[model samples]
Target: MDLDLAAVRAFVAVADDRYFGDAAAGLGISQQAVSKRVAKLEADLGTALLRRTPNGAEPTEDGASFLVQARALIALADQAVDLVRSRHRALRVGVLGTRIASAETVRAFHETVPDVGVEMLRSEGLADALTALARGTIDAFFGRALGDLGGIEARPVYLEPVHVLVGRGHPFAALDGVPIADLAGRSLWVPGAVRPETEWADFYRVLAAEFGVRVDTTGPNFGVDDLVERTAASPELITGVGEKIRVPWHRGVVQIPVVEPSPCYPWSLLWHPRNRHPVLPELVAFTREGFRPYRPGRDWIPEPDRPAFTA
Candidate 1:
């Protein structure tokens, strides 16, 4: 008997939710439509899948067992379609402001895979980058997981710990790594909470709570120039970075580690679920492999006896 995959997906949803109304809502269809589809599935399977109750429906033993197969089939089918679609000629990738800071990653991508059409879309805000990924404007971007990014997929490429960016004259600049408790009333140049998306807006909130750091709100833009300028100009202000910013000429500025901070940049290579470019997998695999257990914050020192990140 020929059975439609749509009917199967609907049936799985019904089984999971245990209510026809919820299944219909999830599928964006009418309740009657859902019942009809499920009924048709039951007819094909030749069994009574659901036993109706006053509160909600419960799947029979057969229905529950069949749900496993149905959900698996739907998921595998979707993945197969996605894999097949990824075989396209050009790979569209979105570069967040932070990844662009690296410069080498961008240049390497082009040099590494010249055939795939590379389009560089600049995003100042993480929310903006994630939005583009969901909206299908761009394939993937470098971002940290925040809020509820439903359709987008994220694969962590590398991690950079939070560091203290201070000016040369600052007292803390001379220290090995400033303790987390020391930042209680310290003026920090922090990324603002009201971001492009409401979901990721709470990341900083959680960070502040965990680190016990009080931050004064700053700009939404992630401009390298702005960061460099802020770190240089503001003696009292410290901008966070994963690694030490050792600018030899900057006599007035310093980038020190924050002893240990919970807020870290897990540089993830994110992409849309539908993007089917072959280069994407290669790029993602390469970066994930290259940066696995990659810690940029841990700097190596020349002296055998001394540890790294000490003045």
Candidate 2:
């Protein structure tokens, strides 16, 4: 008998949720549709897969064993689709912002595998970047690696220092650079709870506590323009940003390097482990072999030998 892939997916969903209604919700289909699909699968296999309980549906003895096989089949099906689609000559890489410092990497990748088309997809933060990778919207991404990357593989690229963004002509802007400790009593504008998609908020908060940088947590979805304007208006208010971040010249803002215990931001390249694109492995290998880790300059001060920011 022919086992349907759709029915297998429905069965796995139901098994995972332990309820037809919840599984249908997840699949974005009706409860009856999911029930019918699962029923058809059970009939084809000649087994009663699920038994209804007061709480939800429970898999039977046979179903518990078959679940393992069902998940494996689904994984294989996904891999097959990925492999076939990759043959069309395209690879998309995800970036957090317009300035992700990935130009060198992308150029190197193209030089190594010149035939495959390379495209860039911009995402808001690390979470969105990973989500896009999982959905196959992008083949890989360059960003800070969080602790839990799920099934994705993270390879460290380098460590970037955080720069202090102060309005031009401000008291702190007169000097060449300022120490990280100088931000002890100033207000640093940061995206708070309102901007739920901003993944680097916690990192800033931790840096503030560590180096005595006073951060203003009260804000509602501030963008690059908002940050520049706010800091230009109030000299006392400042912000920390990645060293590679490109801050447009507004004649009101100046990016100053934070010295004497500079905050280090670790960046990594992330890709789904099972992505079957032919050039994917080649691109990863190129970076893994030749990519250089960040080293501080002679004048740079250590972070009191502090830990690196994971996020």
Clash count for each candidate, listed in order shown: 5, 0
For model 1, residues 127-207, the per-residue Cα lDDT tens digits are 777777776667667656554567777665654556767877677888888877788766666564445353234444555
For model 1, give the 10-residue run with minimal summed lDDT.
300-309
The lDDT of each candidate is: 0.65, 0.74
Candidate 2, position 176, lDDT: 77
The digit string of per-residue lDDT tens for model 2 on 22-78 reads 999999999999999999999999999899999899889999999999999999999
The best candidate by TM-score is: 2
The local lDDT score (0 to 100) that residue 6 gets in candidate 1 is 85
For candidate 1, give the lDDT of residue 9. 88
| Cα-lDDT of candidate 2 | 0.74
Q: What local lDDT score does residue 125 receive in model 1, on the 0 to 100 scale? A: 56
